[model samples]
Target: MKEGPDIAQLGALIGDPARANMLTALMAGGALTASKLAAEAGVTVQTASSHLKKLESADLLIQRKQGRHRYFALADDDVGALLETMMGLAARRGLTRTRTGPKDPALRKARVCYNHLAGELGVALYDGLLASAMLDEVDGEPVLTEAGRERMMQFGIDLAALETQRRPLCRSCLDWSARRTHLAGSLGQTLLSRFESLGWARREAASRVVHFTERGETELLATFCRQDQNSHGNRSQRIMRDT
Candidate 1:
């Protein structure tokens, strides 16, 4: 007979409702205390702690101790990616039967994934970069091109300075809502920070939704239009019309 599935056990660990809710909350890359997670999962602190122990044992989460309190987050990007994939599959399978539309306009526009942008704006930005030959997918990571380096500089991203940071510069993160890849990594973090600094985007209170300012919308349209003109001459018009 065929071998029993290696990942079957792992799948079972994530299949629990409490564990799944905890994972979903942690997907935003925040270190949450057990009490906070308990509230998010609609369970008691003791119950949430029990589930968290199981998840931590499975290497799906990591716990850190600060003073006397313990904080939990996903083990790493790998865990986050797996969770995002599961969410996508669940959505496709009609698990979200009651919620069939965008619940928040800000989420439909742009939002944070841990430290990077996600949603339609993020997806479109990624596509624009690819079309301009600034980035490419290699394995599961995003590899920046020489042209990409120049383009990023033009956008006021200090790529040379970012290289010194001890983190992956470019990674392709699967977007839970868009079902496509958006930029993640140190570069992605920097871009998000820059946007926030410029007042282009702001995080919602107690939510993962990210709101774009009026200036942000204007800037985004202008930047996208310029990239489109450069990439397709007049063909960009046709592409947008088709979409």
Candidate 2:
């Protein structure tokens, strides 16, 4: 007998096709009713209820009561992160869905992963910060430097408020479409919300795709890419001095 935690149990709960679909729908970072989830999984409401019960039992989901309705969402950011990582691995192995259409490109370019950004734009944001010395990967985790905090403040992010949260302020979430890392954690959530607040981007209805207007995309590039160029120039000068 394996003298440790039973991963098989959790695996089985998430392995079912119906359950997997339902969980995927919840990855939108919002609560969904059993009936809506049922539609997503192509199952009946009764069946979805059963699957929801199993997921809730495993602590993979949370059931919330609002008025007379019961809604379900991923238990926490951890569950969402795990699902994103699974998708990334599946993409790496070529285990992707065959249905491709116009929206596919948009999804690959900019999409939301739970509470944070993912896809091409998301990876760019991560890379931009790293190059600018606003973020660092230390001891296998992403950390925000002092200058990073100041930069975030300039971007209208409240660092002090973020520090008060129980959740991590910075985390790296693997992106499935881009096959790279993006920001996660509370700070990541704040950035996404801020973008929406500023009308820079908006999440599509019934979809994970994020649409950025021309102005929004311009602003995003102007804000992050300027720093990227400086970082590149600095590195080139250092190499010239050495060689």
Candidate 3:
């Protein structure tokens, strides 16, 4: 018979606070160097390295070498999806709370998710797409509808070519801030790239926060009406007050 999964091993790896923080940082969808991760985890380099070794051994992370430096990222989207689910459960169980701080306004607007858009704008767009019958949720995955394909084609996405790729076309990634699912997968990445290509959004230097351009703001307002109306009004006001 096949061996059962090693529950204890998985549990032990994530049980450490430092390792948890490191994993969280990776979940933001970028490979980071040990030094950067160390700072993020609020630990010394030595301690972070030790934790990273453990996580790597657990098959939860992967490391790549670039010249002399080593960068670490999650093993795959599977790892990120698992972390997202865990975070969701944690929130449902009241094990964590939303962090409040002085954050960039643009970040609150939109940002990258591994390779796709995330944050309030991303989540709202996902919702709008579902509501508009552009996508359908099936067995935890988002499937593009016929209308979605046509719409994407008009938006300059080659739907047939995207399907030929090995990567998923549509996926749902949990949003850290909104605690909701956003678009992910190749389709998500394509949408983000298209937005950037159109000068709709730009990434902040040394941060994951994404800033929308004036043109982007107008385009998004015209495309996603609900988000446009809600973004700068009662919703933001409430978030500001609550935070």
CA-lDDT, candidates in order: 0.76, 0.84, 0.77
Model 3 C-alpha RMSD to native:
4.4
Candidate 2 global TM-score = 0.92
Q: Model 2 shows how many backbone clashes?
A: 0
The sequence of per-residue lDDT tens digits that candidate 3 reaches over residues 12-77 is 788688888888777657899999999989999999999999899878999999999999998877
TM-score of model 1 (CA atoms): 0.83
Residue 137 in candidate 3 has what lDDT? 92
For 85-202, candidate 2 gives per-residue lDDT tens digits of 9998999999988888898888888888888877777777777777778898998778999888988999999999999989999999988876777899999899989989999999
* TM-score (C-alpha) between model 3 and the true structure: 0.80
- Clashing residue pairs for model 1: none
> Candidates 2 and 3: which is better by lDDT?
2
Cα error of candidate 3 at position 64, Å: 1.6
Write model 1 residue lDDT over 26-89, tens digit each, in one string.
7666899999999989999999999999999988899999999999988876787677677767
Query: Candidate 3: where is the Cα deviation over 4 Å?
Result: 1-3, 97-99, 104-108, 224-243
